[model samples]
Target: MEDRNMKNPLYLQTKMENIRRYSHDALFQFPKKERYLLCRQIEDCIERIIREVIRFQKRYYKKNTLQEIDIELEFLRGLIREAREESYISNGRLADWMGHVDEAGKILGGLLKFYQEKEAGRSGK
Candidate 1:
């Protein structure tokens, strides 16, 4: 039988691509000191989010993994805000980053809700 997980939509892929592009462009502009610190943190969080999404798709029990993705996304938001306040990124760049992050969060949220409902249904029967 074909793998149902392989047939999953491209939402995760698209979000990962957008985040990688944004981080590449934005991180390059950070101060030398923060380039390794805050910049690295943001990049790591993005990777973690991508990894968690992939795991979520493959696993039967997805709630924990989904929660991890949510936490990583929130961490990213905080890092982006810090970047803006510290003058690492301009208002325009901040807006761009936030837009991408928000899109990813919405997509993940939808997946999370879907799985939650599925889990509830399974328990009900």
Candidate 2:
């Protein structure tokens, strides 16, 4: 059978799009003071994650890039939590952001495991 994953190679594309959309909407609701600070940081983190994911796909040695992506993902999650705690975002918005983050995390985790196993097999041979 053909590889289904190859047909839609960018598995995280939809998740990234959801993140970008929600981050903009939720950040727009933040206070003017946070617009330049927390908002910019969140947007930067999201963009970095997207860039890192694309880099991860293009590079042959994805381990380092994946680690960077994982770190950015966690950082993004923390920023979202902070936004919710500071009342910058509502609980409903938090839930929406969390759902997208969780989905991306699951996909990233699976990819990380696959790479790790592949590396191990190569080293063992």
Q: Pick the candidate with the highest TM-score.
A: 2
RMSD of 2: 3.0
TM-score of 2: 0.89
Q: Stretches of candidate 1 above 4 Å error?
A: 1-9
Q: Candidate 1: lDDT over CA atoms? A: 0.81
Clashes of each: 0, 0
Which lDDT tens digits does candidate 1 get at residues 19-71? 98879988998889988889888888888888887787788777898789889
So what's the TM-score on candidate 1? 0.88
Q: Tell me the whole-model lDDT of each prediction, alpha carbons only.
A: 0.81, 0.83
> TM-score of every model?
0.88, 0.89
**Where does candidate 2 clash, by residue pair?**
none
* Residue pair clashes in candidate 1: none
